[model samples]
Target chain A: MTAVLDRAAPAPTPLRRDRRRWVWGLAAVGLVGWALVASGLFSGPVLNPAGSGQFGRFAAAALRPELDPGFLRVLADSALVTVAYAVLGAGLAVVGGALGALAVARTTWGRRRTGWLVARGVVAVPRGLHEAVWGLLLVNVLGLDPWVGVLAIAIPFAAVTATVFAGILDEVPRAAYTALLAAGAGRTTAALYGLLPLATGRLLSYAFYRLECAVRSAVVLGLIGAGGLGYQLALSFASLRWEQVWTTVYALAALCLLADLGGRTVRHRVAEPRPGAGRDRVLSGAVLAVVALTAWAGWYLALSPATLWSVRAREQLDYVLSAAWPPSTEGPLLREVLGAAVDTVLMSVLAIAFATAGAVALAGVAACPHRAGPARRAVGGVVRAVLLLLRAVPPPVWALVLLFVMLPGILPGALALGVYTLGVLGRLVGEAVEEADRRPRETLLAAGATSAGAWLYGTAPALVGPVLALAAYRWEVAVRDAVLVGLLGAGGIGVVLSAATSSFDWPAVTTVLTAIVALSLCIDLLADRARAALR
Target chain B: MAVGERVAVVGASGAGKSTLLGVLDGTVPPTAGHVEVHGTDPAGLRGRALRRLRARTGTVRQHLDLPGPLRVVHNVNAGRLGSWSAARAAWSLLAPQGTAEVRAALDRVGLADRVHERTDRLSGGQRQRVAVARLLVQRPELVLADEPASALDPALADVVLELLGSLAVAGGGALVAALHDPALALRHCDRVVGLEHGRVVLDAPAASLGVTALEGFYGVSR
Candidate 1:
């Protein structure tokens, strides 16, 4: 191989492997092994055999969930609370993101690279931490106020939405904007007319996508003691009420399905806007519905601006700021933070690897091919529904439940995150599969290739690029979610942060938070590099 | 058409040239007439029997439906999927099998240097040649091509036609092509069949017809 490279020859070689992909593949395998070893899989037993009974109870409960009328009423109320938080949070994020996009957009920065870099850095801080972490921190300042849930979801989601929005803005054809400028329009006026019109469809599409995500985030926030379905779930789970837990899971899954269906419809409508119409009725109806929902959510949550600036809120904020100004650099804490960060990265790697593998395997069946036989379509529908349920249940819930069967270690957390990530990645990969060109597969089939062989030679190749891209995107997400599962002593920096926060160790908490932000930033950069290499 | 004969099917855009090719390849069945290839009625064949028959009949479709993200070697090797076991076919994607064979096929098509390049990165003409290279490796007893040289220059088109014709001759099989170029068709084929509105209006030896006769089939006065 070295000799071939030294020659730098363009001559036809005997099927030389892609060296870059080989290196990446080897590195991934090595990292997975190292992570497994670090997780102590080989050193001792990881499974808790005695807990099998408990696991069985949880599994059995799925077949017969709690159906008490009073319990059902509580669940319905909690579901409303969850929806309120999600609507308000996503709505707030969109408003904030739209404004922040202007600040971060390349058109606004122009040639000022440093200014753009700094603005990006500022957004990264908020985006780095998971929503649950924001919930924990907000609870300290806001106490039991409803603002805790909304702010927790909005803060991080706003940062993410802003980054995506800015990218969308930058990708629009700049020719229109520059022409507007050349025609004597002011920069603001020019961007408003030229860029905004071009990006509106994509931006609105993305906002709806965020709303679906916000629904999930709000549930995770509830697990951390904010008021929602997850709060009820957490309570039932603590009492070993398996039936109630199953009930909550079902409700959450139904809610997720609703959001998914709604978001998909709006995204499709936005992508293919009705031609020569005054306005699409579906689009108009969707927008109007969202506005009405947001208003109702605000009223239902009893959100008040005065609560944000109340005296107690100010005093707690000042105290926390003062205590957290000089972050702890104690030797043991720093060492612990470093160790936990490594565990976090490894857990995320294992999770992503597992998710990617599962997603790829399921993508073919999960995608409902238009011309498929009835049985295949039925299988696809079931697979898609299973995926929805997998993602509907939060990672923390998965971690806790999985711990019942498996011993408390990194494996359970990794698997929990893996399953959740698979739910998300599978749908994404399936969509890619659905959208793939069908001609190649048909061509191969016509050439007498077996169905499986044809797919391998044709459909699979087209999907490799997209599947990897989606996996890379999901890997970054899995890292943030590792914290959620880790909060239950699953393994990662989240454990450390939870400990610090419980002890009211503000300085230590601040240090761990910073470390998390820094770790996420590094992973984001690494994932970007990996994606570019794959491309 | 006799074994080892080369036939060119020519007509206007919607003269059902593609549909005829499709029927020959067993994708579209003939509605009114009976058809047989390699002494077997493809419409009645099922499973392994159908696949075995199909493996002997190779086609270069008009769309050149090759997976673009795959390496050129893999795309060329795809021609062997019908004969190879599924496991071998899959493993070949990771570690290509019969490289020398693939290389030789590509070399004949003047694309040997692009053996490791992604198929999508190639130009339209190069991709067409790659498609031709795929059929070369398949070693089908019956060859089918539709506008195989549509993207190529006159010289390259001639070269491709010669390769397809020679491959058919080597296997003692007939070559059937739907061509647009009257001169190329008249030069390379032994027989010419002209169709308009799905009806065969003209069928004669290529040697008996001039380019002007074929051009007339295309509604071209010049």
Candidate 2:
């Protein structure tokens, strides 16, 4: 009825409708580009002097992963440094996040609206930009020290952690908190004893999950000469030694897989542990791991409060801030910044659109049952491995690598991000597929429904909501990443920010940073609403 | 005082039926009275000892609180979680812990093939049976259930109560259940205990209880 009434009313011009259709078509094309980039089968879009020949060689090198013992040993050292930094960074982030969460929790601090707004603003600044960008900014001040590496991961991570932690804390059963408060317990005590325990497991799991992200960030931070497997990879990539890069990549992948596995084990164990030596053993192992990793990280990085407050460091930071103050509101600057922001937003949408599409297509294959045809099984394994690599390498790394074969445009940056997002979205979509109730599909098949028919009628219904939620989440991430990818010369606000930073144009950098921060928070809020609607 | 004494406790929603069974299984404190199960006073048992007491007495509750995310085999294995060492217990989650025992328990409940399936996908009745299978794996000296059949239809309820009766009777242990239906109690139980407003109003052999007796005990007339 609505469509018929609209058609009968003052109709949109055919030209306007065609333009709308064209925009969707471009998104569809971007989605296709996502697949081509993932599969390494598209080349014309990029002015690749190396092209597919080089891309294929690089892709094949991943298959025949360099297993040289000497180099593998070096890779292992880099891996340790990566894990150590991530553990330390994520640990500190948890502490900082917890305090932020407490400060911002509406339940306890709802009366202080100004404080809450200020806290939120503080959290968004770090979380709105990618960790590598933070790394670059830190390098200018901290310079060649492991503290640079550690703080690079810790700062933005802490910000993201604070936001997520606050959200989780806000969700804890308020009845208990209120009950304790009513019973005359202080608000802080009530929160600690009543609410914190309730949300701690979730907080821990999220922290562990962030460890996986931190590992990725730690490597990307390496691109700015911060120490880790990523630093080593950056060095090797710069020299065009794909073989050594693969070794480092393999090491990095192992670290990620280990972190992922350990995280899952701890989450499950802590979520429900029974009386026995089993729980005791697991708990102790976890404590041992955390203590050892954090200690080693701190010791290795030589983290001290002394250096942070050093006159030189403080003076440099002050100088940078002074230079950037009263963010230039000039009309021309505004136009330039606005244009960059638009490019960033469009790039993110394209990246996320393509990533979700690619993920949806491959999810069926990735989640195929082992009982399926052997050929299908092999294809599934290969696809899953590619996805693992895609996710395992940070988005910035993908952007940097793509820059070699592709033109320095948002397209390459978007493609790189799409590939990275594919790894994440593919797993999410696949898990949703795997977790769906198989009984309906089975019944359909048993009743002589074709496999495709059963999937369409039974499985598809359950997947729609979760896939949408994942897409929303990926979009928020892609937006933040779009700015970061500008570091790789991807056309976006990051380029503007990067150009300004290199030339000591602090005012421009500050303006661009403010814009990026605002854009990301808005995107994040929109995505949060989308997820809330799912509930 | 034979081992398999089929005792039925009848009560309204808040008549302390669950608390009574919980005391016997060492899950709740009596506060005023001492209780014994298999000659062991459970009032003072703590830590491992309390867990052991619980592991020995398989008490099914009205709410089937099985973790739905785990496989049927894992849910069943939860019955013996207290008995297994920590390593075996944790490792069991990775791989099926004692597959034969898990399969046998599932077989008794007619869910042999579903041992590897996630428990949440099962129907309401199937989930209740999975709890029963967990009780079977527990191999308790006494079985205590508080209104386990409240969620099932009449016929399914009868079948489940009868299965519980036999699972207890065959082992020469005891089956004590809190029930809503007076008929199931009179038909399946040897002794019936009815409580009204947290106090026992009637205790008699099920064979001697009639419709009038139950109605009077419940303070209802028909």
lDDT of each: 0.91, 0.75
Per-model C-alpha RMSD: 3.6, 16.2
Kindly report which residue stretches of model 2 are placed more than 4 angstroms away from their true locations once superposed.
A1-50, A63-70, A111-114, A275-279, A368-379, A532-535, B1-222
**In terms of lDDT, which candidate is strongest?**
1
lDDT of 2 by residue, A203-247 (tens): 878887888778777777776677778888888788877888788
Among the numbered candidates, top DockQ falls to 1
Candidate 2 chain A worst ten-residue window by lDDT: A8-17
Give the clashing pairs for model 2: A278-B86, B3-B173, B4-B173
Docking class of 2: incorrect
Question: DockQ, in order, for the candidates?
Answer: 0.51, 0.01
Model 2 earns a TM-score of 0.65
TM-score winner among the candidates? 1
TM-score for chain B considered on its own, for each of the candidates: 0.97, 0.90
CA lDDT for candidate 2? 0.75
Misplaced by over 4 Å in model 1 are A1-16, B220-222
